[model samples]
Target: MPQIILGPSQTKKIDGSVKKAGYAFLEKLAADDAVPGLHIEPINGSADPRVRTGRVNDFYRAVLFKVQGQGDEAHYVYLGILPHDDAIAFAKTARLKVNPVNGIAELVKASEPVAAQPAAEAAPEGGHGAGGAAPQPPVHETEPAAEAWSLLETRGVDKEALLDLGIDAALADRAMEATSDDSLIAAVEAAPQWQALALIDLAGGKPVEDVRADLGIDRVELSGDEETDEELLAALQHDAAKLQFAFIEDDEELRKAIEDDDFAAWRVFLHPEQRRYATGGYNGAFRLSGGAGTGKTVVLLHRARLLAKRDPGARILLTTFNKVLADSLRTDLRRLDSSVPIASRLGEPGIYIAGVDSAVHSVIQMAGSEVGAAITEVLGSRSPSIGGRTPASNWLDAAATVPDLPEELRSTTFFQAEYSMVVLPERITTRDEYLRVRRPGRGVALDRRKRQLVWQVVEAYRARASVEGSIDYGELAAVAAAYLEKAGCGVVDHVLVDEGQDLEPAKWQFLRALVPEGPDDLFIAEDSHQRIYGQRVVLGRYGIRIVGRARRLTLNYRTTAENLRYAMAVLAGGEYLDMEGEEEDSALYRSARSGPEPELVPTDSLGDGLSEVAGRVQRWLDDGVAPETIGLLVRDARRAQELVQGLEEHDVPVRVVDAHRDVRPGRPLVMTMHRAKGMEFSRVVLFDVSHDTVPAAYAVDKLTEGDRADALLRERSLLYVAASRARDELVVVWRGQPSELLP
Candidate 1:
């Protein structure tokens, strides 16, 4: 059967009405032993021996070429798709040949008037279309192109390697012309992010391993089948099953590939650094942490798929922070697994995917525990008395009323910390452990008698909650953890946690108890800078260790460098720590591409800011960006609702997505920064960010004096998460004084 190659640009153009037709065309081509359609014709001047254009229909045409294969054999490669005239013109000058070094094809112009040989690497859109202009080569306007750099002489790169590894014609020529490797490196850096990633090694004399290590390129491809097409990018790539434009093996594969993107499979192919996360073998606990857009979720999805595929019977628990993100994970996992059952229940035989709360609840139900009423019903009711009859006061106030309480422990604040940070997390049901515990961060120490009185108050509070049939999420997690510990940790073979930095001590304990301690036990993807929840957990304390099994992805694939720079500045001066209390460095984190700087709209008043933001939202809609791909994020629910109301009043289509079920098309998504975690958008508007609103005074006032710095970091991290959500553009609007966080 004839091999069919699909161009990246061709795949990109296949959407909506043309989507079905495009797939059908591929199906037809793949099924036929010979290239289908009598419309196939050759252009007069094409240099690629196999350059041919065939009619997909009356309007669309497909361009393909040939490259040397096994034993001087040849195989046809799809170049790209274009309209009739454009296709003919593209066929007129387009020349494609395989690159020896990368083993991918490059688009070399056949008609360019140049003193030097043309660039062998594919230019934008798989070598500029007829109407497009190819990139110009470096000038020595008068001199004939300097002899191309010799791979054998410059860097000991084999000139005749079995798998193609030839340097670019233009890049080599430029490299040969340069007096130093530094100049070559500078020139290659000017290429697009993806292109630069592939060509950075062309600068001979620069330690290749050092460059790869610097850029975190850990993988060495044995076969080069990745697309050379410039227009198509593997999204959330790590799972090779969804490479839409890579290559067509058969009709069945083509169908699956097209459908993968039609539904927006939660991210596609993982980057080199991200691939280790999915397939790497570690001795014990492994943690993958990176800034937003670094493909952490992609790694999770692929890693889950790999584990399931490697051992179908192994129980895998893929979990995250909330139900909404869990739902999102489920959706993406389905796209990756396809055949395996991904259920939410913990005891099921297949892979279990859910939020921490859902997983703990399932564990509770399995163990026959009183999971109790919803947290809202419990927190909202008065039956669970803290101290007085009415439930107006917090748990701390309820503990304060025990008579003869030690002077050091009488305050509500102390009781709250003693219970949550120490007693409950430590499962200190007895008074002795509470008295002896280190209480590391807690400044005040308590004697044995004081601990006895505090334990009495805590017991009374728990008894009241148990009587009311109301248990908080923390309580449920604690119960589940204790049960799993006694039962011996065999519920799941592997536990993969996403957004793990936000998990509290109880939740971490629950996870530790759920998975047995083994080689592939627990995998966590967390970014401390993105921790909005006020849960400061040191993972080692919970028995999950990641000291040497940690990798941080720095090259961001989603947002532009400009937006990322501004986002990073928010967490710049703050000392961010990992889940294990180790200093996590983000100074190396950077974006792969550049775009216009973030737009900041400062208005004189609230109404003015709202109106300005609404107008900008309208512009994004009019610019062809999908409404569903745009999001408006704020610091709280009130601000989000207000913005949604204001935008709707201005005739902008907006939807409030406070839950997984709330996502819908034809409207811009609106939510608080807290709700927007684990989500990304093409365009984002972070409005209502004023001095008082960003680091909301309410949140600040709640933190203790020692935690004031942590509170500030949390607030800044919120802004970072919000800003990084914008894939293409970010617009910030505020009234009076704008957020000082903006760089």
Candidate 2:
């Protein structure tokens, strides 16, 4: 049987009519690439004999490279679709070969010089033949000349080494010619996966041997001296090569890659580094940290599938900080492979997906009559509550009743942190326990008298909750953890956590207690820079140690380079710490795509800002961007509501996302910054981010210097999350002076 290889650059966007035609084209190739209707003809005067043009229809043509494998079977690599003349022109100047340095298969244009065209800034199309934009030229070809300095040359990476990394010969010259980091990255972005990564590391001063180890080069046969059919096939099988080329094994997989908009290429393709973490064996708990869009969640989902498939009866719990994100994980897991077993409940024989709180609540429900005993075991006098969560107003009421409480300790912000960081996780029940427990990450220091007053506030808060028959999620998780610890820690064989940075220590304890200490026991994916909820936490304190088992992913697979820069700029000079308290930086983070610089439109008034946003959104809609894929994010619910009314007044369709985070169809989405977490859009407008609006006066107004700093950091993170949600275009509109968070 013949195989059909799909390239990452299959540029035609997928829509209903195009999808039908794309399926017809793929089905013909699957049956036989030689099918007469495809009109697979060799390009005249092409440098490589394998280069051919195939007809998808009269309006579209596929550039292909025909390679014959073992026996009489032939495999055709589908490069991309183009118009008739363009396809022929591209085929004549393209060649497919095994990347000699990295041993991965790659397609490169021939050495024959052609006029360089300006690259258009746009989002990548999801599938085949729907989007109307033509493929843009490689960045290096279109980028203007730079100065005399070279990023790789300064680091002693010569052209020979560049070639050894499998960069195309022409791109290798461009890489060496690059004067600045931006130009170098633009050049590397045009290289194949392993090659680009090698360039990034080499330029970052990583030794060549270390780069080789990072690529797992020992496993692949590398030789630039020869090219063969067997080598091409083996190169195609290499994990890094799979990022740009997928060899479909079945019709269902084919449909997913070519038909479904929700089906991302990353689901089928894995970078070598990501593949290592996803399938590699770890002796204990492992944590994967990366900047936004760096494929951490991708690794988590793949790892869950691997564990479930490795052992049919494996009980795996895949969870996150909230219900919405956890629900997204479940959906992505199914989209990754629907056949992966999904358990109906905890401790079952398949992967169980839920929010950490939901998972804890399930433990309580499972415990039933025994849950009261578990709660008593963890919180001493506190029994399980039936009134659900104690509301925010209850905290203010509790703080007011406590006499002589310091003004700094009187706010709901301080009390919530005090409870989550020291009280609940430390299992503090009495005043003495609260007074004695250490608050490691808290910014404010408390002496004996201050501790005594803080304890009074804690006691009053608990009393109020007890009288109302309600408890916070922190206590709920603590109770669940105590129950699981007593139950002997095999509730699930493996626990996978996403958005691990946003989780409080109590939730971490619950997760640690859910899985036993052993190989592949716990897998966590987090980005501290994206942490917008809760306070800083140290995982080691919660028994989830990842001292040597942690790795960072730096390449962003989502947002464009221009947008990523703007988003990262939002965090400039702000201190961000990982789950273990070490300061974190995204210095090495880079994006795979490039687009227009994020627009910052400053207006004299709110009405003007709204008009500017509505006009841009209308233009995007006119350009064919889907309405549901356009997000109008703000810092508060009031601002979000204001955006809905403002956009509607301009005669643009819009809808406000409710508390459920339900994104309705056929309309632009208006959501608060916090609600935008774990969501992405084709285009995003951050509406009305004025200086007074962003740190959200209520969040930091009445807090201490230390508490104010923490609140400010969370506010910055909120804006960062909102900015990174944009996949292509990002616009920041301010009513007056811009937020200090903006660059």
Cα lDDT tens digits for candidate 1, 136-160: 4453333334844433246554312
lDDT of each: 0.64, 0.79
Instruction: Give the local distance difference test score of model 1.
Output: 0.64
Best by lDDT: 2
> How many steric overlaps are in each model, in order?
17, 3
What's the CA error at residue 313 for candidate 1, in Å?
A: 2.2
Stretches of model 1 off by over 4 angstroms after superposition: 1-7, 10-15, 33-43, 66-76, 92-98, 101-195, 198-253, 256-268, 369-393, 399-420, 441-457
lDDT of 2 by residue, 528-601 (tens): 99888889988998888898999888878789878998899999979998877788976777776767889989
Best by TM-score: 2
